[model samples]
Target: MPPARPPSRTPPDGPPSAPLRALVSWALYDWANSGFAALVQTFVFAAYFARAVAGNETLGTAWWGNMMGVAGLVIGLGGPVLGAVADHTGRRKPWLAVFTTLCIAATALLWFVRPDPAFVLPALVLAGIGTIGSEYAMIFYNSMLPDLAERTRIGRWSGWGWGLGYAGGLVLLVLALYGLVRAPGWFGIPHHDALNVRAVMPLTALWYLVFCLPLFLFTPDTPSARVPLSRAVAGAAARLRGSLRDLRNHRHIALFLLARMFYNDGLTTMFAFGGIYAAATFGMDSSEVIVFGIGLNVTAGLGAAAFAWLDDRLGSRRTILLSLMGLVVPGTAILLVKSKTLFWIFGLAIGIFVGPVQASSRSWLAHAAPAEVRTEMFGLMALSGKLTSFLGPFLVGWLTLATNSQRLGMSAVIGLLAVGLAGMLFVPEATAHGREQDRA
Candidate 1:
């Protein structure tokens, strides 16, 4: 077992301010990474890969699902180990930098993927690598949250970061739409062979590279443990084992993690398929998908920012339940809706709940994790979110293939969300510094 630690100096309920510059810089990492999520994973490139590279939406969607499933599996298995390693080494920024750079490089290399069937394999490979990079980097980035914010304010800061991230994605989607895809010739880029759409890859890479600098340059990292690399690696397994055993004592957190596993998988599926579903079902084209994406981001950003205070006031557990309920309603409506107009309305409504669910989940973990094992716990958090994440995509892809209906494939998400909501009902709210709030 790791040695017992002294009590934290920060009060459990106070609102001491975090350093504004560091806080913003840390949050801006979210902004920086949003370029990849918006452009590559969620909106532009995913649509392009489906319709252009794979030569049809159906095959492309299945392939994309497989790729995401593989990536999720890798992330789920590796995140906790990496977090354990980082916890042992005691510096997270270096790991964050390495993974962020990998993502940027992989994203930039995506510029080589032409809109050809021959390019499909390369596209999936690169996108999967980039996904792995982005998700791994997030483990370290998330673990930094408790160190930055006071106990009572973690939710607000988390929401602010997610809101900023959505705004960043929204802006990038607009730029890709109008600046490149819509008018590539104006910038001396040719429109032939879908090169205009392909250009967004490098553009996203550049955006990530430029915007990610602030976090590396300004955000404070946890102090180094001064443990040698060999020692850290050697001890990681033991530490992870210890952390798992310790988790048994925190039943509420464990239950919360179990609940999160389902809902987060649903969210992951929603993100992976949202654009594809729109294009495939509604017969919307790439430009329409981007427009749809922008609208979703607008609502998601608003919801996250607006719900920031409510997370702290009403408590993270209640905030999550509310968001989950909000998601379920619109999410089901989306599956039933045949009208493109109605799809847009329900999709946008779903987005309003997406960010709050994600942001509050992060804050909840940050607020409840013991200081000694915090990073490892965040890793476990990633594990919870990703471990069965493959199931969501796999089921969607399998069902889509079986039923030949995107709608039916997507109905799996609602089931997953419902399971998570049920599980959450049993979890008590976790409060400052690993304490559970009293049920009475």
Candidate 2:
């Protein structure tokens, strides 16, 4: 094992009580980007692609799975390196801005994807680009957590961000459903060639671009390290190598990352396929899936907000364990029930757990990672969440094709979730003071 490095007593940027405006601005970025997750990735566009673009639900599902698998691989491989480079350079916002623009542009261009089978590759490519943008942007965004709030309040802020994200998804879904998809010729958008569905693409892009401004304007960013770009790039490899070596002395974080790797993959698979499965298995249309998505978002937002206190009080580990149990039970039940009504019940129940699992995981890492290498650690966090992420989607897509059963394909999530839960059992609870002791 490598010799343990001394702990960093470096305080977070800003006072313990960070300004409310900065905090809210930081949180709203979550709300902004969720437009993409809600409309493009989950409800509106995903269903449309499967049902309309590919002209075959099964083929579209498989293709979408493959596309996401590739995106995950890219994100996993690039995140740590980019994070190390950013740490050397000492600013995250510029990187965030670049990727955010990429996502917005890709989302806006999705408007050109018509209801023709010929557009399948274009649609997948655009969505893949957008997904990559959103995820890479998140590495920097999540790294800012420790700087935005003190350890005592990190859970609350993380939860608030997630809750707001879900709320944003809910609101966007409603607007897309009632104003765009369900409405006939709203704002002069014609019903011809599925233009109404395509219109949601631009709307999502506009929403993200508009709401993301506050973070750039109001949220405080890390001070520049003044390292030249060339120098930062040159040193990134060495820094990343050292960061990986240092992990040997931080077994708790390593274990937690491993546990997160499996559970997050389960979550990613669920997000990618939830709408596809609903439509393919239940014969629901795009509009119906949007309504279902709205309800799920409502429950998820409330659960995240409510659990913010629990994260701090019960500790991040317990909170995550409870949330995982909540997910595994209802998630399993949803697969068994043939009735759509039961699916709704179980699906909504699953949503309640989703927010806590994500929020607490962020808080857990915030409390655990040493301050000096925080961004690099978050990059590793992204790697853990994404490295094997392709496996979940690939398995689902493969099984869906091989067995011709959406139900059986989705069962892949259950095993992943169960494995994550068992892994969590061995990880010690993380706290702000615990981090101090690790450094000692």
Candidate 3:
């Protein structure tokens, strides 16, 4: 069905509207905290958590997947409801502050995770808490996009944010590799204690807290009326219900989200398991993994920057569609290679496409959602991406358990990419009449 005309709410805030300092400050959050994502979630700690904590490669991989599965369940269900609450409260900064503290504290605390079986569950739980803090915080962070820059430039801003995140991750990974390579005890800590790996947690926490101040101190926020907490909850619930009821009327938004839900599952699964899969499949130690991570981050940073203009010129839908198509081919080819050389080549392909898929998806959401409900819609956007977020992880865990082959387990992501691409074909172009006016 053709979507009914959307109601009015979005007001354009173009480049002239948002100062460059505020724009950089806004984007810097992506740059600041991505070290946690690269080090903990994607590379060093995930591998360490699985191999060192869980005690066996196969079981550790499964447990790691399951841990993230649990995090996904929490993030998927909570993001929308919380987003609705934020929309009504008109207090994005306060919530961002709370979650920022939560994430930083949680990351720094990972220094204490001992290499014992008893530590696994608690470690996973802590990681889950950090994941929630970062992911939940982004519900508010992302909602600010529509108001930060005009429609024509949203993609550029989104892409740069993503690019900066990759760059941040890359820089941290390089530092980490240098530290590890110089000596296991390079920081005056003994190698016997495994402190080298654990040391990064505290450092990332420090890095994130330091660089994130600009956005907290500088960027402006939406004005909202004060409502009692109890009343706000009731209002948010009603708004969420209204959004659900109105989905059919906003069919393209619904489909766009649905497409994202599937592709994001694949994207997230690749990230969650990429380190473990590489380590298990290729016998890559910490130093090698860090190098691999740095390579991917470099390509991803460059790719996101390159695609930002493409997203604006070609439209968000086509840009995302192209990126997803790019994913399928590389994702399959990775399965065929075992050497570091071949893996790097194919892995970089994954890197190049992944950024465009993410940046354009955000751009599309910013373009497609109704203004009044943009925050709420982005929340649902998080919900959609995360709701089935477990399916891919659980499958990777379960398949690896059953088959004892991480290669076969990794293949699960390609199907999701293909499915999402097919779904994207059904979404209407973002330039529909009412949305077009919002861009102006």
Candidate 4:
């Protein structure tokens, strides 16, 4: 047998260490970048992009929907290829830097998008680039887990990072809501002026830039493999080709990825459209939408905090299963509720589960993957998550367009969730269990 793997490079002592700091820095990337997900991608800009900028409500929604679908496709297809490159090169941070910088630059460009149909196409493209870049960057960051947390504490630590990310998103939401969203009149401008929305984009770009400092400064980079960059890329390409061919060989992993794809599609659809469903159904204004965003962020943070302990106590799979059950309730309620009050009530249920599910999923991966191949597996996870992203939105958008009823669009979400819930049962009960068996 091959010699036993070297004792993990992780420090063998108490919590405080260079590795812990590095992990925190990695987590902070999520903290910093979440603002884009919360304010720009989901709520405020989604409305602005769909209704205001596109100028044709139906076409705007369809256009944005298509952009997301295309992005999902690209990331789904390309993730594993790049992921293997990181593994072969032993250079996760550099990849993270390249993608994160692209995200930051694209986010900066969002400032130039005025509320006009002429700007819609470029805006959608840049937004897609930013979305794909940020998410792919996250793959490398997550692969750092083995170098940081002890196995037993992975769930709690990962949960804390997710909670911290929600908190970051919350802070940005409050700033957007109170500083820009509430002020309507700023520097001699009306509150409802379209330019007010434009102003928030620059701030988001700045937020991403500022908060990413910790990772670059505090975290130690992974040791680079001796391969030159060109050779690394070539090696990565060949390995990627082989991995795809060998996919069927990793049956349990492939099965888990399929389940993740199904459930994540549902989760993503709810997040992407929940606010729109509220607005279309209850006639919510921008201010109400802002409030809803803030509320969800708050609940999501709390949920992450609560589930951190639960994840450790019960295991990642159990936490995820419970969280999915929670999501199903709110997800179903959206179709049934006619009033804004009930929508928020149900939304609270969704917010409660969102954090735990996300945190546990990451933790589960940490437990499941071998250190040498963690980056590749995490990249594959990203691919699976993005695969059906297009389908869910396309299905919802098409259904909504055909029926001209937002309720019907949301009703479609329930089917995705139910499928996801069923799929969850098939994933292993504890990713750690699989790891232990491998060690045996």
Residue-pair clashes, model 1:
0
lDDT for model 1, on a 0 to 1 scale?
0.89
lDDT of 4 by residue, 232-337 (tens): 6677677666665666666556666788897887877777776566656788876788788889988999999889999989988889889989988877876787
Give per-model TM-scores. 0.96, 0.96, 0.95, 0.92
* CA shift of 184, model 1, Å: 5.3
Report how far residue 212 has shifted in candidate 4, in Å: 0.9
Model 2 TM-score on a 0 to 1 scale: 0.96
Q: Write the per-residue lDDT of candidate 1 for residues 1-440, one digit (tens) a residue.
A: 55333233335553356689999999999999988988899889998999989998888988999999999999999999899888878889999999999999999999999989999999999999999999999999998888888887889999999999999999999888988888643466778988888888999999999999999898887778788888777687777877788777888788999999999999998899888999889999888999999999999999999998899998899999999999999999999989989998899999889999999999988878777677888999999999998999899999999999999999989999999999899888867555786454
| Angstrom error at residue 116, model 2 | 1.2
TM-score of 3: 0.95
lDDT of 2 at 134: 96
Residue 315 alpha-carbon offset, candidate 2, angstroms: 0.9
Candidate 4 RMSD to the correct structure: 3.4
Which residues of candidate 4, in runs, are more than 4 Å off?
A: 1-20, 184-193, 245-249, 431-440
Residue by residue across 279-326, what tens digits does model 2's lDDT show? 989888888999999999999999999999999899899999999999
Alpha-carbon lDDT, every model: 0.89, 0.89, 0.84, 0.77
> Could you give candidate 3's per-residue lDDT for residues 8-118 as a string of tens digits?
335543323488888899999999878888988989889888888888989988888887888888988888878877777776788888988999999999999987888
Model 3 pairs in collision: none
